[model samples]
Target: MFAALSEKHEHKKVLPDLEGAENGVVMRFAPNPSGPLHIGHARAAALNDAYIKQYGGRYILRIEDTDPKRVDPEAYEMVVEDLKWLSLAITDTVTQSDRLHLYYALCTQLIERNGAYVCTCDNEQFKVLKNKKIACPCRDQSLETNLVLWDKMLTHGFKEGEASVRIKTDLNNPDPAMRDFPAFRILDAPAHPKVIAHVYPLMNFSVVADDHLLGVTHVIRGKDHIANTRRQRYIYDHFGWKVPVYRHYGRMGIEGVVLSTSQMRLGINDGTYTGWDDIRLGTLRALARRGISPDAVKNAMLAIGIGDTDISFSWDNLYSENKKIVDPVANRYFFVPDPVTARIEGAQPHTAHAMLHPSDASRGTRTLEFTGTVLIPKNEVLPEVTMLRLKDLFNVKISWDNGMPTFTYAGDSLADARAAKAHIVQWLPAQATVPCTILTQEGEMSGACEPAVRSELGKVIQFERVGFVKIDGVGDDGVVAYFTHK
Candidate 1:
C-alpha cells in the first residue's frame, strides 16, 4: 500500500496512494473531544490532510462526542483551533452528537435484518456463554421482540444497564470479543455537552454509521484500532455497503514528554505544568509557543512515513529540521544572562556592527555603540581566562581588581584571538541593553538583551550564543521570550 512521494510537493518521503483516487476520495479525522490535540494527534491529522491534498478530495474533521463522560465541552472548539494552527485543509466539520438519530435508524435496520439484536443478558453471563461458543438466549428471540426491546431502550422503558443493542457475529469465533459487541447502551448519569440523551451509541457503532453515511472512502489511523476496524467491518458487511479502504500505521512514541490528555490535565491541576502551552508539555500550543512552525511539523511527520514498525519521535531531528527553516530568517542578537558589568581600561569608545543574520548580509546589521563598558554573562567570566573576543566586536584582555571585572584592549584581529586560544563570546553595550527574561523548560533566565529586539515582537530571533527564541511580548518591563531550540 505504498505510492511514490510527489516530487512536485514539499513532502520528504513516499506515502501510499488511495485505492480509488479518481473517485473523489473522502477521508475523516475523527478525534474524540477529550482535550486539545497533542503531538500524537498531529501525526494522524497530518497523514489524513496529506492524502486529501494529494488526491484532491474532501477532508472532514469529525468530533466524536457520543460518550458524554469523555467529552470536554471546551474541546469542541479547541480541536478545530488545533487543526487550524497545524494548517490542515478540512473540507467539512462534523460532530457525532448531532447525528444520534442516524445511528438509531441504522441500528434498527440491522436488527430487522437479523444482523443485530437487543440483548438484556447480564454482561457476566453473556461473557460466559460467549466463551463457551454458545449464543445468548436473547440472540434467538424473535425479530418483533428485538424491535420492541429496541423501542423500549430508546423510549426509556428500560433503565440504564438493563438492556443494550449488540451486533451478531460468529459465536464460534476464536476471539471472544468478536462474538457479539454492544452497539448502543443506556447511560443516564452524566449529560452530554452538545445534546441531552439516555441512549448512547458506542464508538465502534457510531463510527461505522457515520463513515458509511458520510461516504468516507479511506480510513487511515493507528494500528491500535485494528480490532475496532474488524468490528466495524461487520456492520458494513451486514448492510451490504462498500467498506472504505483501511491503512493502519504503527504507534508513534514521543519520548521525554507527556502526550496523554488525562495526564496533562492532572499535571495542569496539580501545578506541575503551567498550562497546555507550557514549554515542557508536548502539545501543538506548546510547540507554537516555542516557535516551531507548522511546516516543520508536517515535514517531520512525513519523514516518519507509514511504516508498520513502531518508531520513536526524535527531538534532535525535529530541532534540526526547525533550524533549517528558522536560521535563514531569524535575526541574531546578543543576550547576556546573569549579566555583569566589565570596565574597559585601555579600550577607546568605538562602534561595532553585528550582522542580523550570519549568512544573509542583505538584511543589514545592528549597530552597537561601545563606550568603554559592556555587559557579558557572569558565568562566562572565568578566573582562568586571560583574553576573549566579544563576538563581532574586538578582543578584550581580562583582569580582576578587588573582585571586579576589568578589560584591556586587545588586538581586533580574529587570527590573533585564535592564536591565543581565546573564547569568542556574545556581549551587549551596557547602556544599550534592555531587561529580558527567557522562559525555558528548566526555568526562567533573566538578564539583559539588545533593545533592538523590541521591534521583533511576535517573531522568532536568535540569541547569539544562547538559542533561538520567540519574542512573546515587549513593554516597559522589557522583553519576554520563549526559548525555541538551539
Candidate 2:
C-alpha cells in the first residue's frame, strides 16, 4: 500500500533528452487481476505500452485487483507474465488489492466533506433506481446524520443485500449513473476475497482515485471502459484534479467470432479450448501454440496503431502476419500423421537431399532417408494432392494410388518444386488411412474438441495435398498423431 509512484521519461516533443533530463508525463496499462488476460486485454495493453515507448514516457503495469472476490497472487502474476510475453513493456508495477485502505480512507474523507452519505437498501431497492433518476431516500440526510450513518455502515460492515454508502448528487439528472449514485455498496458477492469488508463505488473509487494518485496523464484503454470514464471525470472534478488525455479504442475482435476476455475465461476454464494455448482462439497462448514469434504478434497487432474503432480481421490475416515472422527462421521439417505406411514397392532405400530453403541455400540441406518403405502419415494424404517434403525435398508432388504413397517424378519436376505450390500431395497409393484428427480452430474442446487434435493446431503450416496437417499428439511409436484438414 505504498503511495503510488510515477515513472519519469524525457521527450522534447521533437527531441528526447539523452542524459535523463526532463522526461515528463506517464501512462499505464491498468487491468483487473480477476481472470486471465485475453485478446481484448492484450490489445489494450499493447497500445498503451506502444504509446509510452513512442513518447518516452513511463509504461507502468498497474493491477486493479479491487474486485476482492477474484483478485489473487496467481492472477496478478499471470497478467504480468502474459503482458511481458505480448512484448508490452512495464517500467513499474502496482496492485490495487494492496491499497484498499487508501481507497476507504478517501471515501471516508468524501463522506466527511458532506459529498457522500450512507444508505440502507436491499436488492429491490437498488433496482428501482437502476435506470431511473429517482432519488434514494437518504439523499437529503444532514451532514451530521450522513456522517453518523456512514460510520455505522463502516463499523457494521457490509452484508449481502444490505446498507450502503451513496454519493449525494443531482437526483433529477437524466443520466442514471449521475443521479445520486451509490458511492459504495454491500457486496455479498465481491469479485475478490474481501467481499464483506468494504463497499465500493465501482468506477468512482477504482478508476478516479487510481488514475489521479498514479499520475496517469494519458489513459490508453479500450472503449468498453469508456462509460466509466465519465464517472471517473466526476470524481476528478470533485477533487478539482486535471483530467488526463484519454484514448479509447474499441476492443479487438477476431475473425468470424466475437471474443471477450470475460468470454475467453469461461471458455478456457470450461474446457472450450486446450488450456489457453489452443492457437485458434485469439488468446496469446493460442498464438504461441501456432509457433508464432513475439515479433510476428507485435507486428500484426501493432500494424493497426491506437484507434478509436475496434479492430476486426480474419483469423487468416493474423496467421499470415505470423507466417511472415516465423517462415524465415523455422527450420524446414516434414511430418505426416495417421500414417498409411507407403511402400514404393522396391524403390531403393536412397538418400534424397534437398535445400533447406531453395531461395536461401545458406539454410543448408536435409537428407531424407527414403527407404523402400515410408510412413506417409495418413493425415497428410488428402483426397486432394499435396507436396511431401523429402527431408530436404524441394517441391515434390506426392500421389496416392491403391493405398500407397508415390512421388510423380516427371509431370512435376525439380524446377516446379521451388514454388510453394510445387509441393503437391495426394495418397501415395491413391488411398490412405481413413481420415484422422485435424487440429484447426486452436480452441480447446469442451465436449469433443478437448484434446481433439484436428487440423486446426497446424494453422501456421500448409500441407501439400491436404489443406494443413493438424498434429494431435506425439505417438508411442515415435510417430505423430495427426488429422487432415479440418
Candidate 3:
C-alpha cells in the first residue's frame, strides 16, 4: 500500500485514477449509523468525495444499519448531516434496512446452490469444531433441509444464538476467521432497539451484495477491513460477480485523543462529557464547535493520502494547517485578559486606526477614539520595561509612583520606538471596550475587547498575539467567541 504513496504525493492536487476507470468510476461511502461520525470516518468520506469529483463520477451515501442491535435511527440523519457539513454532495442515499428482503433472497439463492447452509451449532460446539478444522454436522445437511431451516430463521423458528446461515469456505483455511463465516444471523428484535427484522445479514454479506448491486466501481475503506474484504470475496465469487477495485487507507489518529464511540457514549451517559460536541471529544461536531473549518479538516486528511502505514498527528499539526488558511482572512482584534487600568499623562485624545487584517488592507481598518485611560493585559506588564509602544498608537514611557504604574508620552515615531527597543503592546480605550468571553479547550476566559468585536459576530478573528477565535454571538452584556487555534 505504501508503494502508491510516492505516486499520490507526486500528484497531490489531483486524485489518482482508480483501476478499471474505463467503466465510468463510481464510489460509495458506507457508514454504520451507530454513532456520530468521528475524524476517521470523515477521512473516508472525504476520499470518496474527492475521487468522484476528480473523475466526474457518481457518489453514493450508503447507510449500513443492518445490525439492528446497534442501529440508532437518529444517527441515520446525523451521518447525512456530517457529510453535508464536510461539503460532500452525495448523488444518492440508501438504507440497508430498506433492502432486507433483497439480502434474504440472495441468501436463499446461495443456500440452493450449496454455497451456504443453516447451522444449528451452539457457540461452544462451533468453537470446538472450528479449532479442529472440521465441518460441523449441519454443514452436510440436505439442501432442502437447510432451505427449510433458513425459512424458519426468518419466521423466528430458532432463537438468537441458536442458528445462523454460514457461508461455506475451506474448513482448513489458514485464517480461522475466514473458515465458514456467518452470513446472516437471528436477532431477538423484541430485545433490540428498533430492529426491523429478526433475521439480518452480517456486515460482510450485506456490504458485498450492496456494493455489487449499487455498481460501485471502487471501494475505498480503512485497512482494518482487509479481513472483511477477503471474507466478502467468497460471496462475490459464489454469485459470479465482479469484485470492485479496492483501495485501503491506513488509520489516521490524532495524538492524545480517543476516538472510540463506545467510550464517548459512556462518557456522555456518565456526565464525563457534556455531549458529542464537547471540546475534548473528536467527533466532527466537536471539531466544528471549536471553530475548526471543514476545509481544514479535509485538507489535513487529504495530505495523509491512502497509505497503509498508520499516521499519528498532534493538535498543533492541524492548528498549523488551519492558521495558514485563516491568517490572511481573520481580522485582528484587541483583547485584554485580566485587564489593568493605565493612565497616560501629557497625552491628548486622538483617534487610532488599525487594519482589520495585516495582509489585506482592502478589509479596511478598525477605528477607536483614545481617551487618557486604557485597558492592557495585566500579565503583560513588565517591571523592567521603562518604555513601550502602544501598537498602532504612540510610544509611552513607563514609571511607577506610589506603587501605581503610569505612562507618559514618549514619542509618536515608530523609528524612535524601534531604536529604544520598546515592546509593542495591544490596548483598548477603556470607554470603547466591551466585556468578552473566550471559550477555550481549557475553560472559559473572561476579558475585555474593543467595541469593534461586537459587529463581527460569527466571523473568525485573530486576537492580536493570543489566537484565532470565532465570534459565536454578541449581546448587550458581552461577546462570546470560541477559540479556534493559535
Judging by lDDT against the true structure, name the best candidate.
1
Stretches of candidate 1 exceeding 4 Å from the true structure: 1-11, 400-405
Query: Can you list the residue pairs that collide in candidate 1?
Result: none
**Against the correct fold, how does model 3 do in TM-score?**
0.94
Predicted candidate 1 versus true structure: per-residue lDDT over 124-174, tens digit per residue? 998889899999999999999999999999999988899999998988879
- Please state the error at residue 332 of candidate 3 in Å: 1.4
Candidate 3 lDDT trough over 10 residues, lowest sum:
2-11
Clashing pairs in 3: none
Please give, for residues 1-486, the per-residue lDDT of candidate 2 as tens digits: 111211121111232222221355587888777655766666667666666676677777878766565565467677777887886668878766666667778877777777777777665776587557666667667878777776666675556557777666666656776655656665655455533465554556666777878877877777876766766766666667888877677666666432455666677789875565555465665555545556555655556656677667545655566555444434333334445565553344455554444455786755555544555555555657656543332234566677555754332244555454544332222121223344445432111111112323333333333333334443332223222222
Tell how far residue 322 is off in model 2, in angstroms.
1.0
Q: Mark the regions of model 3 whose C-alpha exceeds 4 Å error after superposition.
A: 1-16, 190-195, 401-403
TM-score winner, 2 or 3: 3
The most accurate candidate by TM-score is 1
What is the Å distance of residue 154 in model 2 from its true position? 2.2
Per-residue CA lDDT of candidate 3, range 1-486, in tens?
334533543435555668777646789999989888988887888888888877778899999888776776678878888888999868989888888899999999999888999999997889789888999999999999999999999998898898999999889889999999999988786443544578889999999889988888899999999999999999888988999999988877675455788898899999998888877888898888777888778777777768888887567766876776677678998988878888889989989989998866888999978889888888767777778888999998989777667789887999989998987888989888999999887789888999989888877889998889988889999998889987
Ten contiguous residues with the weakest lDDT in model 2 = 1-10
* Model 1 whole-model lDDT (C-alpha atoms): 0.89
